[model samples]
Target: MSPSKQGKSQLIDSLYQKAKKLHWKQCEQCRVKKNLFKFVR
Candidate 1:
């Protein structure tokens, strides 16, 4: 894979892991907002 692609995959994986560590209720709103921003950008 290209270096840029690899970096992006790694970043996504790290974000998924961090999200998994959060309490569901605590993370719900933040996760939605983050995903919205990600999609918008």
Candidate 2:
């Protein structure tokens, strides 16, 4: 994978881990991911 792709996935992974640690609901996680996607774009 390209560097950009790898970095994005890693960012998502870290966000996911943080959400899990905080015990966020699935919907909340989805929303966060969506916001992150917008920011990334």
Candidate 3:
């Protein structure tokens, strides 16, 4: 309800989105590595 609270909520939401993106990126990298290893073997 207050301006400060609203700002904090927005900051937290932004951080959460960033974290989700990073997690997905890491997952993708792992998948790629796994495929590469499979191909090499």
Candidate 4:
């Protein structure tokens, strides 16, 4: 909700999309969401 948190999440989301484009074989969308969220926390 905070500005900094929003920025960090946006960055992570972009990284996720970039990874997706690169064909990160290990990253499924559902699983990656949880893992990335946990990684941020």
Candidate 5:
């Protein structure tokens, strides 16, 4: 991959990791409710 493209991919990976953490936290907080909302479509 090109330099710029490689950098973009790395950034995207970190963002995905962060988003995953947020998703888990939200699910835990909403466990009492029957319906769960999606963060990603």
Candidate 6:
């Protein structure tokens, strides 16, 4: 992949990882919303 594309993917991966961590910290309704966001993405 091109450098820019690779960089974006890396950023997204990191964000996803962060989101996963946040998932556990979030309340039940927010967790469900995040799950739906993940599915839609």
Better of 1 and 6 by lDDT: 6
| C-alpha RMSD of candidate 6 | 10.9
Per-residue lDDT value at 29 in model 4: 71
lDDT comparison, 4 vs 6, better candidate: 6
User: Which tens-of-lDDT digit does each residue in 1-41 have in candidate 4?
Assistant: 99999999999999999888767655567688999999999
lDDT, each prediction: 0.90, 0.92, 1.00, 0.86, 0.83, 0.91
Which has the greatest TM-score?
3
Query: Model 5 over residues 1-41: C-alpha lDDT tens digits?
Result: 89999999999999999999999998878873534444332
Off by over 4 Å in 1: 24-41
Total backbone collisions for each predicted model: 0, 0, 0, 0, 0, 0
Question: Can you give the TM-score per candidate against the true fold?
Answer: 0.54, 0.56, 0.85, 0.55, 0.70, 0.59
lDDT: the better of candidates 2 and 3: 3
Highest lDDT against the true fold, candidate? 3
Clashes by residue pair, model 4: none
* Models sorted by lDDT, best on top: 3, 2, 6, 1, 4, 5
The local distance difference test score of model 3 is: 1.00
Candidate 6's residue-wise lDDT over 1-41, tens digit each?
A: 89999999999999999998887667777878999999999
Stretches off by above 4 angstroms in model 2 are 24-41
Query: Against the true structure, candidate 1 has what lDDT?
Result: 0.90
Q: Could you tell which candidate, 1 or 5, scores higher by lDDT?
A: 1
Q: List, residue by residue over 1-41, the lDDT tens digit for candidate 2.
A: 99999999999999999988777677788999999999999
Query: What local lDDT does model 4 show for residue 23?
Result: 74
TM-score-sorted candidate list, best first: 3, 5, 6, 2, 4, 1
